[model samples]
Target: MRSGNIFLKRNEVVFVVILSALLLVVFPMALDSFRLNLVGKYLTYAFVALGLVLCWGNAGILSLGQGIFFGLGGYGMAMFLKLEASSPEHTAIQSTPGIPDFMDWNQITELPAFWLPFHSLTLTIVAILVVPAVFAWIIGVAMFKRRVGGVYFAIITQAIAAILTILIVGQQGYTGGINGITDLRTLKGWDIRTDFAKEVLYFVNVALLLGCLLLAQFVRRSKYGRILVAIRDKEDRVRFSGYDVSNFKIFIFCFASVLAAIGGAMFTLQVGFMSPSFVGIVPSIEMVIYCAVGGRLSLFGAVYGTLFVNYAKTIFSESFPELWLFAMGALFIGVVMAFPNGLAGLWQAYAQPWFDRIGQRGAPRPISPAPISPTAAPAERRT
Candidate 1:
């Protein structure tokens, strides 16, 4: 079927406009800098939810360990920032005046070879984009070629997350331990801690999110999207149709990983820190919950779901920190059981039909048949 446009339908284009207005215009106008910054942090997670929709929702590959990619990306960004923060002037008190404090604290005299590339901003950006893609490709090739998938794939991802988290925590000298890489103060000679900087970063984050949304839309409407749907519904049929199903799966998995990594990098920028705490099993599962609550099949729903869940988490945790976990559990259960399609499903079922009815009423009706209809019925009955 021909599309209304190359990427989005007319209505979808309108949605993009409306969403942009809401995020870029309305939000800044209505919120204080602090609150707006909080919302920006929430938007970072939307990247992961968006990725989840791409892979799990569209491609039908459930991964329970997205935090691995998120952490890696954040760490990539953090490494660069930490190097900047650890200038000799700032660390002159330590035995090694140029190394990160955590490294110095552990009595390490030199930076690790792996961290050398992050000293250059160009290489840091490249590493941020490339590392996650390569890692995901490795995982995808290893598993998909062997036909390992479904819940097994999910459990394996979880195991990987656990392993990565342990490694980060265990290598305290290099990784900063559980405390995480901190004291992040600036980027490229700009003070990120300033109010103006936070506001700017918030807008930058929102812009990236909107761009990613368009990217997701493009992918979903493309031929590749159709193939992903087919794979999800009938993988064996797709394979028999001469499509290399594993390659498609591997490509999408890499795509999703990169999205998560981008979010992680942005999270580091806006939040000013990165930690293994955000890289473990719990955070990974929470990312999955964000997608599930948003209606994984709906790209827009995935984003809205992230905002809703994170907002709820902030408010609920503020008052009842102890009970927040239980509340989260219940919320997930309720959304799964009652609104299986999530908020997007509700809109389609109730709101979309209402709009359709309104449109029909506004449209011109056909002229009624002449009065002969009644006379013909009587004549036919008498005959």
Candidate 2:
């Protein structure tokens, strides 16, 4: 196929434009500050779904511990904000005026060595990005290099998520315990709790999400993406073709982790807290469901899926409460049994064809082949 043809198709272009308009223009205009903030929160999950599309959809690597990376990035940012909010004057009543309130509550007198680095805004930003990537790299290298994959890999990832959640919840003073990191007041002297700050953060989140989408699109259209698919279908064949298949898997997994991390950081910024509630087995599986519901293969579909599922959750949980879990279970089962490729798959199978037909109708018809081709052919034969 021509290189130009490898990228976005007409339908895909349309999808991008429509989604962009909804997120950037329509959403801000239609929703109030509070609802718009909620939408922004949902968009953060879309980031996780986007990463899953690359890793699970294309590369066929199912990671059940994505929440670990998300938490790491979120906590990284939270640590900085927590520290800033714990300025000496802010904690003047405490014996140790410069430490976080939780630490002070636990009778801790000084900041931990690890928390010291987060005092710098630049370092905090770097840590938010790097910590998750590094953690992912280590896990990827260990599992992929050892040829561990499939269900086993998934189980191990789930276990890791469980462990991280336990660690965070167990260490009350250091990690804010079950409450997680709360009381975040400022971001480099700017009060983040204000509505205007949230609006700014929402735009920032949207911009970053779009940037991530473009990056994913580029990878999906490149030869490397084809190789990932090949490996997914025939791992041994790809390995025999002189490609270190494990390395590719590791790289893609790390890339996915980074994306999740970015989403986590944005979540912390917008939500005003980072909690262990988001970094555990249940949340990790839910993240996968978002990808699955969106059509794991479709990045744009993933965003819509995240939004749809989250919105439904809010509505159902508020009204039906007890039935929400059952409804969610049924929805998952329905998606798998009826539309394996998800909403995107349904669109491609039904809606896209209708759209194409409409476009064809609008196009100029070929001059009816100058009919009477039967007589014309006979004249040529006689000649």
Candidate 3:
């Protein structure tokens, strides 16, 4: 039995590797720059979705504030980019250059002091990872220690994201106000507008996505992972088992936050900007929807969910922008009703047979089941 399980696990790993290679290598070659860029965006989201799978899918925690972490990471990178772009002599410049933009229209002269630290790439990257984790740690401790979960947890997270967006937007001088940060020139001395830099960013995003997926898998397979599953299945029972459930919950929460930050950082690097619009309550809900549509229980689901949904969004919003939300709502409903396991779940159910057939065609079949002999039946039963 153990041997059979090991074989199955190996097969699954091989399949995942093959799929990842195709996404990272094959698709970029075939697709145009615009399409590849869009796909890259989905891939970045996939990283965050994978993180959600660890926290919410396997661990049974419903967090809706992943966008906040994402925004923090994005803003971190944006701050650095903006600072790097800014002239050394003057403290502030036009938000979008030339016409003075909105802030210039409002007579703003200098950038806020907080924005100074972001001038350094090293500081920006560090802040991108640390800020989100810190926020998650604080919020997780406060809420989990007080025993918040389920709908309450989700609501609080959603509110937190909303509040953060408002704060960023209201802090005009510091955060670039409602306009946020835009018109980024370059990153680390490389021209962002160049195809070379774009391609580099694309590959970087892919690498980060792969890293995040592997890290989540590691956590999921660890001993603590099993405890998380136990806690998810029965929190009271897990507590009775002498584990500090709150600490475990907090740990997963923080893990998810860090993953979201990575995703966000990759996203801003690709798009070359950040805005409050990117991290509001709606985006937070959308992140949840991505996880739900993909497969709340599976990592593949989260990634596929982000990719598939984003693809659909691009198609629908372009063709029928007015009805995009309605289309999404209908699609969500359809998935909820017809594919309860999510798209990944559906793929698992149906695709495995085809994969097994291909594997079996090339590989030797296991030894046929030994026929039961009448004389040996009693001995076998006794053994």
**Number of colliding residue pairs in model 3:** 0
TM-score against truth, every candidate? 0.94, 0.94, 0.88
Ranking by TM-score: 2, 1, 3
Give a tens-digit lDDT track for model 2, residues 39-110. Answer: 999999988999999999999999999999889988998999999999888999998899998898998888
User: Which candidate number maximizes lDDT?
Assistant: 1
Candidate 1 C-alpha lDDT tens digits along 1-383: 23453468866776778888988999899999999999999999999999999899889999988999999899999999999999999999999998899999999999899989999999998998899999999999999999999999999999999999999999999999999999999999999998899999999999889999889888888899989989999999999999999999999999899999999999999999999999999999999989989898988888889999999999999999999879878888998899988888898899989988998999999998544455477767555
Query: What residue pairs are clashing in model 2?
Result: none
For each of the candidates, the C-alpha root-mean-square deviation to the true structure, in angstroms, is: 5.0, 3.2, 4.7
Clashes of each: 0, 0, 0
Angstrom error of the Cα, residue 15, model 3: value is: 3.1
Clashes of 1: 0
What TM-score does candidate 1 reach?
0.94
Residue pairs whose backbone atoms clash in candidate 3: none
User: Ranking under lDDT, best-scoring first?
Assistant: 1, 2, 3
Please report, as a residue range, the 10-residue window in candidate 2 with the lowest summed lDDT: 1-10
The residue ranges of model 2 lying beyond 4 angstroms of the native Cα positions read: 1-7, 366-383
Q: What is the C-alpha lDDT of each candidate?
A: 0.92, 0.91, 0.80
